[model samples]
Target: MVPDDVVTYPTHWEADVVLRDGGTAHLRPILASDAEALQAFHVGQSERSTYFRFFAPLERLPDRDLAHFTQVDHQDRVALIAVAGEEGHEKIIAVGRYDRSGPGEAEVAFNVADDHHGRGLGSVLLEHLAAAARERGIRRFNAEVLPNNAAMIGVFREAGYVVRQHLDDGILAVSFDLDPTERSLAVMADREQ
Candidate 1:
């Protein structure tokens, strides 16, 4: 059993989101049992998608990495996944996570299946992950993307956050506060419509 003071699974963060194409997906906290599905999801992504995420052409995630990704503590390290289909047929279509890197700050990352790209899933993951991080006392989120990953940068910009970026060694480092501003909320609301 989990210690009484330790943060447990946050079922409250689970959500059913509608994509830009009117498709539906379920977003929920990651689980230890999700290793296989997560690996399968990675296997299905395009080489471009894999490179954008891992910064390398990995044929597959090693068992250790799989274990690390699937096992997360609800407090400092957290992950969320967007899944499609039902029960045994479920497929992990996307993933988002935040790892606390400093006081009141966290490093965020995401991966969306190539087939689901441009459906606004990245924005949805960012929104939910930010909300979850805030609940855990994170005040800011940061990410590092390859210079050519304009789509990822676009997702961050379209969220209406006052995103700050710095390019170094062909990588773009982006960051923004987690606090929701009027414009951020407005952008979120507009997308939800």
Candidate 2:
């Protein structure tokens, strides 16, 4: 049995998204039951993708790490998973999440499946994650990306938020204010079309 005080997040967070390549995916909040799927997704990533995400050579997600990533309160810490394929055959193609760092600010991260690269899934996931962050009163999203991850950098650069970057120790720190600029709004509008 479960405790009554444990709040389950609402289903409104779920969405159906169409990828840039005309493929479809279901985007929803990460659930505790998704631990195995998340692990499989991690294992499916390429070595470079894994390093860019975890900042180290991780052969597998340990039990503790899997639990931490799968369980979330959905307010201070939130994760959205993008799944592709049919019901039982579903696969986690990408994940985007944010951890509240301070009032009005949160640290963001994302990982896309190796096979799903260049399909605009990252941008789609980022947009949804930003919306969720704003709803939770977060005004800024921050991220640290390796200098060689041009794809990730481009996603942030093309987003409508005012993005600032600083490089130190081969890592690029990027920040985006939640206030959407005209360019950002236009880009989002185009995505909806």
Candidate 3:
């Protein structure tokens, strides 16, 4: 187990972070220290999810990608993880990021462990991440999901994102805009599931 003291909440320049779920999951700034864990997680993803995320075959996280994930400034980029830590279970199960595209706009992306999907972690992470982004001056948050990724699509749709299937950056994409009050998400979450 990560001694309770060893699992410290990460710091962020972009927002006030919090550790929730008994620190089994946390909303914190991704750091250079996270490179190895992030790389390993991506490397371990299932082939299908790897293809969905990269839009191609990738066996491991390329150095450039690792560098970008670990070193970007908070204004230009930031990431979060749902970390699990116990004697035999120390790992990052879910991850997401937001990269600034312009004033008031950010391109966001998220992924969860195959075993953890459909358990509300993605929605919870989005709720926290979107709120954090809003606090950091981002009014519009966008995401790109492959046409075949129905689980992610369901999450976005359930979150009340106005999604339009369109060709973006040469691939099918689904974009999301976060409402500050989350009325849309709450209402959508209320409907038949």
TM-score of each: 0.95, 0.95, 0.77
List runs of model 2 lying over 4 Å from the truth. Answer: 1-6
Give a tens-digit lDDT track for model 1, residues 69-169.
Answer: 88899789999999999877999999999889999999999999998999989999999999999999999999999989989999999998899999978
lDDT-sorted candidate list, best first: 1, 2, 3
Backbone Cα, N, C clashes tallied per candidate: 0, 1, 1
Per-candidate Cα lDDT values, in order, are 0.91, 0.89, 0.68
Give lDDT tens digits, candidate 3, residues 49-141: 888777888998889989897665656576777776662355877877889988888887887888766666676667767777777788787
Tens-place lDDT digits, model 2, residues 1-193: 2324337774677889888888889988888888999999998889999999999999899999999898889899999999988878888999999999999999999999988998888899889988898899999999999999999999898877788999978899999898778988898999888
- Every candidate's CA RMSD: 2.7, 2.5, 5.6
TM-score of 2: 0.95
Output the number of the lDDT-best candidate: 1
